[model samples]
Target: MNAQTKQDLLISIPNLSGYDSETRVLMERACVSERGNGPVAYGACLNRQIASLQGAPGIPNLSGYDSETRLLMERACVSERGNGPVAYGACLSRQIASLQGAPGIPNLSGYDNETRLLMERACISERGNGPVAYGACLNRQIASLQGATGIPNLSGYDNETRLLVERACISERGNGPVAYGACLRRQIDSLSTLPGSQ
Candidate 1:
């Protein structure tokens, strides 16, 4: 992150000492990488964390799920450290959708190898949170990739150049999938500027 962005984040969340080191790091990274809206993103993240920690009760009710599914949902949502209600509810919702065999979750089978690899890595990072959470993570990251702007089309590039671009993009992934996608976009844009890269 740039010095100015870092300064802005610290100024916004002046007392991050209460959070563990890992969460603090993730919070800062998520905030800064949130489509360049650091302060607003940080505030949202902070609110979520606080709400979750306090058991603020805005989470989805278990009225419809069966006993086993409700138990699984609770375990999946609470298994992750520092999970907020928004994320927890999202996990529950995804689990419900998965149980119903929902059709909207994009199939990654058709994606190019490099893009698939990055998406896999992003989801793998959430594997510890259980199957429901992992599925949720995959859905979220794939949506992010699909919705993101400026992702260059790689059909014109040869295998070697594509691999190089993939490695370059992954190397610049500072925090998570959003930043990784941004890096991929930037690397491809940089290639366009080269004299004979076409």
Candidate 2:
């Protein structure tokens, strides 16, 4: 993060402290831990924090701070952290789509490997693939789909990516010869109830 960015985030720190427990834990986890952290390191940390904060329920009402936060989060997830930003970034992505028990999930504009992993895991979980399987399931990432039951949370992804993910998730289920109808229905139902959507 630049000096200006740092100052901006610092100003929001007090607001962050007011967030609920889950958001606070998530924000802290976005930063990379190192005794020898540099500007790049600081940027990574800041990006993760911003991503988590933007996904919080109250972000929409945060007085335009949400846009600044979303930009920083995207820069970190898509550019700086590479794979490292995935875990934190994806958490915010999934939450962005839903964020239960609150006002709404804020709009997050970008995605990373972490967020893709989140989609896969969520798809798998909903498919009743109970115990998460590492290599046993799927590790692929998809971007967009036309009629996917449950829509993903990224606005910048192309349509093809969405379809790919939906297909990949289904293949990973490895269940009986059932149709895809139920899965799609559940996904649609779930997404319609997400924070912003609801």
The residue pairs found clashing in candidate 1 are: none
- lDDT top scorer: 1
Top candidate by TM-score:
1
Please write out the lDDT profile of model 1 over residues 98-141, one tens digit for every residue: 65653323467877775666666766655544455556666876
Clashes of each: 0, 11
Residue-level lDDT of model 2, residues 51-98, one tens digit each, is 644534432222333553344334333432333333544534543443
lDDT of 2 at 89: 45
lDDT of each: 0.61, 0.42
For model 1, the local distance difference test gives 0.61
